[model samples]
Target: MTRLSRWLGTAGALALAGLATPALAAGTQAGTTITNTVTVNYQVGGVAQNAQTASDTFTVDRKINVTVAEVGNATIVVSPGQSQAVLTYSVTNLSNATLDFALTTAQQTGGAGAHSNTDNFDTTNAKIYVDTNGNGVWDAGDTLVTYLDELAADGTKTVFVLSDIPLGRATNDVAVVTLTATGREGGGAGAMGAALVQTAGANTSAMDTVFADGAGATDAARDAAFSARDDYTVSAAALTVTKVSKIISDPVNGTTNPKMIPGATVEYCITVANAAGGAAANNVALTDVLPTTTTYLSSFGILMNGTVTGAACNADGAAGGTFASGAVSGTLASVAAGAARTMLFRVTIN
Candidate 1:
């Protein structure tokens, strides 16, 4: 066809504008083919001629982006010696292509946690798992995975950090942990892909890699990884016991400034105190074996949950306890934090 006006060659084609535009705000899917075609109209000697057309195509590059965010707003409260305490998180694949995300965890070394609580301890036996059931809670059916597999673009998965609280952790002690998700190549099933590398220079016909992730709690921006922090706080019962004895009466003194001697009545006060800022101690049980030199006062039985006045236990408690096998035993039901309760019993010197 004879053309009245001719278009530029490869140079003009390469300079074409608006040939490919981002399809979504997140990003166009990787490997998506975008084709641009232009047609030229011409006339020869006042006669219409066939149109000539040129087209160019390119694949959308992959944009690696992901986010790891803590799932809850508060620190997880746990007890001393508690096992399998959980800190939940979410990993979102915000890239234009499916990706495998490598997961890792770090314990904060004495700093503020995500909840702004001081991190004073480290958890033991920490492990990561994926919420295979989408229940948002870690369970036996959930799969333990080191990396998220075949997560598609715009997909999100719940993650869990399971750890054990040490036996001696104090109340209100905090242990902070961070979770990071690094993007990698996807497409292979049940296998982890290689790490992603950003394509240098300019665009190309083949799909390239681009890092679009922002900085996280523990990772730098554009590193193809994101991180978030969570914390475990201890809420344990700190208990202390104290025992004191007082002579109420003797056969010779008759309850007037009595002294410790044979046939004297000795009252034993056992006080159990729980420190403040700790959890309540429940089902508290106490037992004491009487000394061989003392005879059990079966008529007095025992006083439980008694009031302590002036460093001495008053007889204001309910009649509760058992005396058998030369020992006294009772249960205090519950003792709240920062509170003290006493169990009182009497014995006569043999």
Candidate 2:
């Protein structure tokens, strides 16, 4: 080492040592006092000097805080014995430094009849994920992680809590799910004994230790709370379908208890019914093809209506829809609860 470089290094160390005392060796903590004084140890052509020390102390501050808020109050309208509800939350790091947080969710712990009631139904397949698509909505494709990693102070992340509601839940049954976040290791909340935040392998030097106030009342580790909730409702419906047949005329059976004879005209009735219990069935449609050994009449393809009775052709295709070859397919009006529909088509025995 050069002679000048060695002398300068020694002088700088001596200067810092001149100001060093008990407080310099003391630990940093929350709500504490700190005092500092600078003393110069140097020579200008071998001259001496000294500086005054301040005995007045400054108060240390513990502002490791965060705020958690539900993106919005979410209430899913669903069918009984139904589906999943995904709720969004915003977790913001309000601290001055970076922090890592562990996330967790709990069912309603509130007393009876509370909005957080989970008695009616609890969630299934519960999970949490991050929003990577930049959209506020949780897309099917998004990054899934267990913790909120390295959030900068004043920064926020969009997170989703996804869960499925069990079937068999009664109508108007509501279940609330709550989400909570706590401090984790690698930063402010490392393992016990020391608050040193390890960057790579593990804690090594004293410089890695974290202080609530950065020195002297106590090095207490703290967690932040940002919680939110959402609920779901269910409703159910029952639908039934029936098919019947009638023989119009048979060259052999003579139209009474007609047998499957060639040239015999057959009428097939397809009916659908929905019991009066829930909302109407939507986008209802029926599709079918003529069975083997039978030929669908090119002209009389399908008869669409809500009513049909015994073997009589008493009712024509009043509501019969446009025919489309041997294959029958078309949309029908939504069937309301307690309502029924019937469609008939004629086919000749091959």
Candidate 3:
């Protein structure tokens, strides 16, 4: 037998002897060692053939080499105007062996700013999850948050929790998230055993563990390398309206006093400018909305020229013009970005 096998057999014999000892409760140190060996046998048909083989054996002593290193104190802060608080925590592996951990929260009690134990905060239900499945999408079934596979020696990982409570609730709505690390020295299979060892590799390396470690393993370090949530408040300022000035020009100036005569046509020009800091588009209809003193006339034709070119205006000796009912309808196109246009109207009043 190999030296490892002999050691294991001896240890097993001692364990049986220890059970019969009366001093077992006195804390007598028991040394244990284990050995593993592989054997292979092969045979060929036709002629009877037999083979026996044994591989080398290796031994291991059972001992615990555990080291715990904390990345730093975690913190969760909320912007003043926001209703949710974001929590960020970090844990580091100081042991030579890898570590697997799970983080869970417990409410604070019997403190100045203590809060009642309630399920108000759920990390899984939050808008931002760790994307555990690597599918680039978040799903309802993937709600279990805060998990770490293998954190190598000198490595670290960060966990995030989003809370629904507002920031101003209790000044310090404190809670504790326990980070339970489990594994064996030199990167053993841990509690997950050999199956996980084959699938995730012998090393205790996980996706988030590598990500946080590469980002420097500290909460502050990771946060500095990325962007955190931001809060904002939006509101309207003010609204106002102001009137500027109006312009009027008579196109039909005549030598006769009270220039317009009955049955005579005249043209009037009206120009309105927008003098405000902002711009506005207006399609103001130029309806006479005539007074009772004025009489309705014939078709009020428009003149595109600089001078009057129509007989639609009244030759009656009057200062203003008149038009038939529903005499004009046209679009003003569009007002220039910051300019003005003049509209001309021709009519006759009796």
TM-scores, each model vs. reference: 0.88, 0.51, 0.26
Candidate 2 lDDT by residue in tens digits, 193-301: 2232323354433223233322111112343345556555454445687877788888887877787689988877777677786656666778777677888865666
lDDT of 1: 0.87
Lowest summed-lDDT stretch of 10 residues in model 1?
A: 1-10
Writing each residue's lDDT as its tens digit, candidate 3 over 97-126 gives 344544334332222221222222222223
Per-residue C-alpha lDDT of model 1 across residues 129-245, encoded as one tens digit per residue: 999998888999899889999998889999999999999988889999999999888549899899888999978778888898999998899999999999998898999999999
Q: Tell me the lDDT of model 2 at 130.
A: 80
Query: Measured by TM-score, how close is model 1 to the native structure?
Result: 0.88
Q: Residue 50 in candidate 2 has what lDDT?
A: 61
- Sort by TM-score, best first: what order? 1, 2, 3
Q: RMSD, each candidate, Å?
A: 4.0, 12.5, 19.8
Sort the predicted structures by lDDT, highest score first: 1, 2, 3
